[model samples]
Target: SAGSLQELLHVDIKVLMAGSTLRKVKSRSWKKQRHFRLLEDGLTIWYKSRWAGKGHSTFSVTELEMVREGHQSEVLLSIAEEFPAALCFTLVFHGRQGNLDLVAESPEEAQAWIQGVRKLIHRAQTMDEKERLDQWVWDWFQKADKNKDGKMNFKEVRKLLKMMNIEMNEEHAFHLFTMADKSGTGSLEIEQFVHFYKILTQRDEVWKVFQDYSGDGEKLMLEELDNFLRIEQQTGERSAQHAQELIERYEPSETGAMTLDGFQMYLCSQDGSIFKPEHQGLYQDMSQPLSHYFISSSHNTYLLEDQLRGHSSLEAYIKALKRGCRCVEVDSWDGNDGEPVVYHGHTLTSKILFRDIMSTLKEYAFKASDFPVILSLENHCGVEQQTVMAQHLRQILGDTLLTTLVDGQVPLQLPSPQVKIYAVGTDSFSLLLVYIPTFILYLCACRLNAHLLIASGHLIPTNSSKEKEKCGAENCPMASFALFSPLLQKSKSKLSRELSDLVVYCKSVHFHGFEHSRLHAKCYEMSSFSESKAKKLAKESGRDFVQYNTRQLSRIYPSGFRTDSSNYNPQDMWSVGCQIVALNFQTAGLEMDLNDGLFRQNNCCGYVLKPEFMTDGNAQFSPEKPDERQGYRPLRLSIQVISGQQLPKVNQKEGSIVDPLVRVEIYGVPQDQAKDETSHINNNGFNPVWNETLNFVITTPELALVRFVVEDYDKASRNDFIGQFTLPFKCIQAGYRHIHLLSRDGTAIPPSSLFVNISISELS
Candidate 1:
């Protein structure tokens, strides 16, 4: 009886039959506020209750009916005359009768009350009534099946739940759909489908709903629909209000209303809640520039000590760091009593106390400006000492530090206004969500990419929330706060659909020089569920579908990109994940080596393509999309060339035009042409070395292996790299010979030697 009542109302309210006839009703109290939710043809109202702990109670109602002014008098007379046993009818006239809100004292009473309301609201005056309901149900199924692949997959379903910040796991996801698939066809069919939500989301499986209703037979029946819809609407309303308040509190606009984009900005702002930037030093300015490229040099005990010594004095440290390094990496372990002291590795020698290091920096009069440190703490200590390290770091650094740690185990890092701690090293990424309730891998990815932190995939937790939040409404209680992923999608309350509006809010924060890491590849991955639909539609439309995944990143990203994989063994898959964002790409103080061939040959050249819409640094992509497929626009590029030698352009006429499938050539010249040799081969293949051209032949995709030949010769070895470039077709082209002799260090390439860029567009 309790279960049935809970399903119809979608509330966590318990009806205790304390003494048979004396049933006691207790509702879950709101941890936050009250809101409204939608169910098909009905709605649910939710408010915090003193009796209920963390769940909501929902009740379904039918649409109101209208009667002429004179008819109301007749309707009341007819009801009293025809069925006197029925509860007294109340007229909430906005001209007619609203749906009945019947109160019942027993389970049987409530059941009778609902039946009465259903009869009163469901007007079967014509055949069109049934047809409309059928059409509505069918339309819903079509809409939910985003890929049009005939089945609603987990990824798709999870995206819907993500808007509400709910995270579901696979086993639970299966259970959710099984309950929703009313016909038991092992799949959802419109015929058996109803707008019943409580039937869909009553399970408590961790990831069941998060997978987007994957793998199962879960179709909601008509009877169970109202409760789910009502709960969702109520939760959504409450969440929207809470999110708006957060935006208003942290980043209020000149106007009272906060834009969605502005709210996103608030989360990713370094100077805001999660990351706070304090000004220091004599030249401190509110408008002081921050470093974009965060360079970290790793070494053993000697280098570690040297780095510490280099930054021992304020003047010296400022000079070394002002040259523009963003992170200072260190290794640490727990002492006998669980005290966190910094050391390179396990050692018997004197180790540096974290306080001592900070005191030394302080003694040097190093201002906060000189030490905008992202201390990467490598925890070699066991799990038992994990919290101890965290406690010590928080104690030593207070509010001025932002640190990231990665041990193999998931750490218990919670969210606080002052300290932003994340568990970096994990195998599934989802484990982070499991271990730490408020920590999300999705946000972590965004944080790392936007220069909020340097994240290793093992310890990094961004993409998991995107994949974890799609539990079907049937498998879990709508009001379970335990089901929500606070890090991925946040909400002031569990039932709110918009949750905290974290995604949109973070987007706004990113624009105001606050780096929200989730906006990049993580967005692409989260957006992929939708983007795939676009790709499918384009295929149907006969347009090329240039869809890019994590695998194809090499085609676009530069070849020399390196990430923090220190915690993992070199061979672990987590150690070699693709970089979603290159945080260091935009730092201004130092000349970056953009041409490291991590992607293609002649590693000395790199290109940065701006999407066509960016103008004056304002992003042009429409932030919102009707479907996931609608929003991504075309890409434009701005090329940056960094070479140990000069770069040569493709000479139109004189250069050999090798067939696309036959040959390839990359040109390199001396940094200073006057000091290098120039060459051109004669018809006899003899010594007319003034302008010699180099050609590389390729008969198959594997022939591109010639790109690796640079490793053979000492001088030319390691000169060319093929990191992320994809050799799509069997091809070859050896055109112009423009080689430049460059000194060991990459600096001062002669401008006249050759360096040029051209624009091209490709769809993804």
Candidate 2:
């Protein structure tokens, strides 16, 4: 009867198993007793309606299981299969161990030996046939050979082995390579690699053997290799374990990994000498591409806060605030009778109660450290409204907020200094008209000891019509310089100067700005000639040149820069090409960190333009035609590594030897700035300085060679490390064809840093 009731565990057992009626149990005793009758069996039981609402019911069982274990039979728990309904099931047993004993023996074999759990319930699904070992290896080799090179490089091979959780060093690399290159020509060709692939994929047993041999933990060492050869000489061929042991013996002392050079020595008693010119000075040159950051001003504070909502959780937002983001904007407007309320609009509907937002922030606020959150309140109304809002912010954030006007006027006589307020101005508005003059307001805020003040304004263009008309082309520079001359002559006050610095600090400054093609889509125009002969003529005649014009300057210069076209004029072509070369060096060779600079040049050729800072309705410029007002084009330099050499293996137990500094120097500058010149700096062409005093010892032949990257020159230490740097190659109308190192032209140091040694076997 109990087994039948257990079978109906999911449904009401009284109805499903017992076939008894609930109406028959209707008595005063049934209400107080908390009991029910099973339908079919007419069995009485205690019950509670735990899951009252959702379409589910709860049940519990109190049972006993007694088994003679030595006699050997499986006793299954039927109640445990019902999940949460059997959550409170109590199974009383005569000889079974308790819950604590089961936990303790789980770590030992007692539970495994006594549980009688013969079958495994969970198993993994079968993988697709395409994912077999043979297919994976073929795909890996193809992708690894980027230029269809027959062999895979260290970087490419290392990445694949790393994914398998088997760090394949140089020693193990050749072992696997030789295994795959079955016919042993020191290389594996694509067409001839069919059998290895077939063996790898055809059987799981074969694949497993390869995996074991490839794994570093099981690979052969040098001692094992020698033993294998000695034994094989007496018998026949070498075993896989012997080969693995031979490979393991060549592991480097420092990292216990093998490099290509070390692997070759161990495998074939040969050192390979293949070098690409581009990879020569890789460790010495440190030029890197510039990093970009975007800054935008929200028209009002509520919109700014609303936009940032989904980016991070409230907890994360508070965490970020604690980390460092001090300058924050809050919009406020005048309430009834000019009581300040934290709202961005003049209308009352847009107003948000200050207390509500503060309460929400407090709920999730990180309060480990105390750092003031600078609140910039913009008034929709006039200065009067701004004054009222400042008072309200001071009340809400206390001394954390400050109030000041541009003319060095402070409001509210608080005991401690309040927060600094900045007055923002636009190109269309003068400083005095925008709430408070920005510069003067910043000074006033500084006098009150405010932490930050942001003076928002537009950078007036150098080529503005008003500016051009005042001085024309010849005197444009003088006119532009004259306008700012007066500001430089003032008797600088401590507060005013400090405030000016604040403005400069907060301003989004662009360094080495250039136009890029991605953002400035219509900046350059490309036209192709129908006939190749005509196209050649046009290109030769300097008539088919494409031009890039900035109808509007980018928010950041060179946000969208372009390259030269195939049909461009020689002068234009060379200039664009030089720029590409220069930018390449800037990104790849030098090691200076720039806030903003020329990142990289595209494959397409065209000159870059400073996006017009401000656009004019009347200003017209042709995209196909050039004007001298576009300014002087400067030549850029890109560095290339020509050649390099590695030192001979040495025994490190002896004295150390210093490595020679490999240097490349570029020298040449045009004597006259105005000369239409084509001379490299100092008439020697573009030179890069590369000196390598940094050295590591090779103490033992066992594992001494290590690879290190030479990034860029450290101005302070006079050494090099991999870092961001920029070498500004200054040449106008100057063409540098190539980079050279140690040359009457470009020579190598032949054998300067090479060192090798051999010691007696007794030293080992």
Candidate 3:
């Protein structure tokens, strides 16, 4: 009755840390007492109602982002007047999941749960593959131990195998069960079950590969290990020093040489990761001008879901900022309360107090990236509320907000995000109007101080310029940014002039032809492009687009037709050197994967410097005709699909077994796009092997992304996506590697991976 947490009485945690009945608070009017307990493994939490239930309700510590105490969340704050903040705590989860608000009977109890959960989360995060596997097995053991006797009989083992999507002959199952039940009690304990699991999940694939490399059929000498790395992994490096270090690190038992155990561990290490470990740190140059890098950005940063009927909350801003997004959109409108509100205007999307959003921005702006954030203001508020917006921004952001130009002088190019803590461009001031009559209203927003202000506006959903709305057409947001023009500045009012004078580096402008831009467009004048328009330009005038982005900042956003808040492939825009390719941060898909993959490096600072060819305004570069460009060298990439380890099962039916398949896709220039896949292995979600080789020719490696996809194959219907991992093509290391797969939402499904051999050579 006390639960299996009797075993959780570890030295670090107190005995009372087992479980407690805490009040789960959904709202101020609704609170229910639920019994909460941490499982014995310390990775999962289980909660139940007062009455006994047939099934269990649980949440993993891995799902949690962090735990905050004392009315830290809005839900907890709602009951602050009724309940003391000291007795309340909130569990913040990753992604779009809602927060868990709870109240303890006393402050001491609350601290116990909070500190206990924090410790568990820390342990879960630090666990290695083997440790994770052990916990996973323990979890299964808990599920199968129906009598709560800490042991499993033949019937339960058979049932457990079915639950794990494994169908085995009864005789063979019993034979293995008997082998594990060393005491001959006709039942197996936790240790016995672990041994049985090891027998069932024997790595035959690993043994074959090991036998291929190990000359003595046991261990490898230093030269033999070097040969394995050079010949089998295609590293082509014969070094005793590197081999010795690896042998020392992976080979246990003080063995001087590498053994099968060491080989297996090394194959699953950071050195064996598909993404080069050397690229994990702050490896890229960050000193370039802001425009010279591809910046991680989010469109409609207030909306949590689709544009229509979505709740606009500060959590969206927090999520984006925490994920290293440098550019965040704020659609400011005049609220009925005489304050500015941020939301999708004219739609059923909920509204949030603009000041609250500002406060969240100030708190989380530098948590993920120390780079300067671009606050893109889509102003719809009147002058009075605009002034309030300005006040709140200044008040909340304080010294972090960029008010004046760096060194108080005009900048030739936008400043680097790393060079300053925040603030850079001057064009953060003017062009805040919705209608021409409200031009002075935007001037009222002059009091606002931000690091970088990339301003745009829309009277309705889209700008009413007939030529601009091409079903999925692009609009040059010049009407809203009209005040920044030199001609408009001459006769504008003083308030207007105050804002206009502040329009420094990033003055928004309409993109005409390339010839026109070459002759007239200043380096500071940037352009915004819709997805379709940007794609068209990148296809028709790709060279010009690349050349244009070299000197000016270009932003590409999704088309208005994407009401579901779906994202376009950011790789396309990045290929054309678009600095700001904004996506719906609330949505998850292949597009966001590419965004995450590209920004996963360079300290994850939300900025990746463009390649040298794309950095010069005069450089001859074309994403379409990459083969013809200077220094163009096409490379051949070959990936050998080997085996999958501990992949997750999709179907929940007892008899269901997944037929797994691996697909490799390349996203890049028109000529370099390719896809290759392996045939499915029937009835095997665990340790399926297919030694198929997939090949591709990448003409523009710098702009390409390689994606590895695993799916549960079904001939009768659409296959279920198991997991995938995506990264820039150039980040791949040519060697034997393990690609750790990720779930649909991009979180790590630990211990799930694909073993492979990679080779890169000049295309012949």
Candidate 4:
């Protein structure tokens, strides 16, 4: 049967199924033979039954998670109680929550199956951008070929670009199509299509960078190379020796001079990889607790415009998820339809169907990063709609929804089919728990009760008592000493037995003050503070906030003043080790750019582990108190601003010779330090040379970002931003480096980079 199946399938499919065995397992009432096949993009499992005929299912490799031993084994054992002797090795599908247990005939056979599946998974996990791009091109070709033809025409190419959200001029598209159509038939084959894409995406700046140093317009002489290296060097007089070493390393022919191809290879080798191989350990530490990491989060993730009148679309979720946002917010309100809707309540924002949002979540959940997505549900629906909401979530999310503890703890029983939903009622005192699960659901008060709280302020003696009594009473306003005694008596009636079962790890409480967070009862507490309040707290009591956040999760969101849905600098919160620094995902600015840069490390998995000193849970460490630790060393950063290549023009005129200047900024705690050239070079956008050096004394190099901004100088008007580059100091290499400029929207401006030399040293 396997041999016959092999003949029916493609060569690549047969190779993946070559060593694996097919076994018969009972599905419902009928028995079926299961055959596993790996595709370029995903895995296919075919099932053939005697009476029920044949069926198959395909799963994206990104969605597949191999569940072995421990909790997985326990779940299998529970399932086996029904079937008695079913061969079981559980495979959990993320987001979809589909679980499949393959039955092996023997222990050795099961081991082989596990090994084979894991090997495929490992290959999928390590699939780099280039491989994914190739697969995408193939997939796009199939989709664009509407008639199932082997070739695509110019119309199909335009449709393909539209599908990919790429905006290209009609002339450029036709030109590219003509170039790819080698047969001159006005159509492109798959090979030609891929070639066209590769050429289109290829950076032409490599040749330009090479030609910048090439004196003869062809090859770089030894003396010219040496002088270039000397200018690139930070504090060295041995540029001649370094130049000799570089020539020996990159020189391909017998000639002493370096060719354009050889120089391009040297540049490619340096800037090719975003994450260096040596930085692998930074992302590999998954053993730590979830609270020990800073999670990339988005606030009001459904909104795409102004906070009060924005359109709420599923596109927002897709964009945020693709950008490595692990935590997303959903504001659910009961819709006119039977199902619930997600939107900002009390606003003119349009709503989207809850089911549609769930479907979007399932599709794009693991596309950017293969990590668990946290759905921060802000429920505003009534009990009936809440029940319907839970039903839809169960039907949609299925098993991918995390119900139990993922921290390797063995639960008393397997997670129930239903989710544990929690909601704060309109009355504010009433807490509703709709499902049966031991997991905790955080519920924050929607409305502010400043007037009521201020009137009853004296009744609440201290912030600690306020927290304790508020938890017991479930009141929006902190129960006062007068109200606390009676509330404690009536707490039994208000609190349900299900509350104990639901409240486990995370409990949402309004942040009172820094001192309130230091209390013992606030250990497992989670707090959401406005950005202004958080900044004030950080300034007034930064050390306390840092110590508090070291153990528990603290969320910082934009203040109410940001009606435009603009984002604040998340790096400020991150500097203090705040876990959830929520930003407006729709708006693109310096804030979101820094957010992208920080999470770009660690596979952009949305969760970056906090530094060791921050995670130690000791109050002794502080960014302000740098002298307390030996690891805190003063860094001397020296940057040489050399020249800009094909620098972007502010004005749209054809032959506008714009005046440009470079402004260098170092952002970190203690305050932001900046410096800029006093004068701007006029009449040169092609290549403006500064040949100036700047120095900065960094007290905390670990939490610093070096940002280089290019602006067009104007005497009559304000200077306009041409483009800028921002990156962490840790990733910056010491030598001749290229600073690639990015637009305000975080898109790369090709062939635009500031050539700079960097040298970092410790101050004795």
- lDDT per residue for candidate 2 within 183-296, as digits (tens), equals 666656664444433332232322232233333533334444344334421212543444444345444343334333223233222111111122222222111100011111
Measured by TM-score, how close is model 4 to the native structure? 0.60
Error of 1 at 190 (Å): 94
State the lDDT at 78 in candidate 3.
79
RMSD of each: 32.5, 27.7, 8.0, 14.7
The C-alpha lDDT values of all candidates are: 0.26, 0.25, 0.77, 0.63
Model 2 segments beyond 4 Å from truth?
1-327, 335-339, 343-376, 381-388, 392-764
Q: Candidate 1 on 77-183: residue-level lDDT in tens?
A: 33434323233232221111122222233445444433433443443222132233343344445556666756654455554333222334557756776777666
The candidate maximizing lDDT is 3
Which consecutive 10 residues in model 3 have the weakest lDDT in total?
Answer: 435-444
Tens digit of lDDT per residue, candidate 4, span 315-358? 67877887788888887777897788988777799888888787
Steric clashes per prediction: 116, 68, 2, 4
- Pick by lDDT: 1 or 4, better one: 4
Off by over 4 Å in 3: 1-12, 15-17, 51-55, 234-239, 421-504
Displacement of residue 41 (Cα, Å) in model 3 is: 1.8
Error of 3 at 402 (Å): 1.4
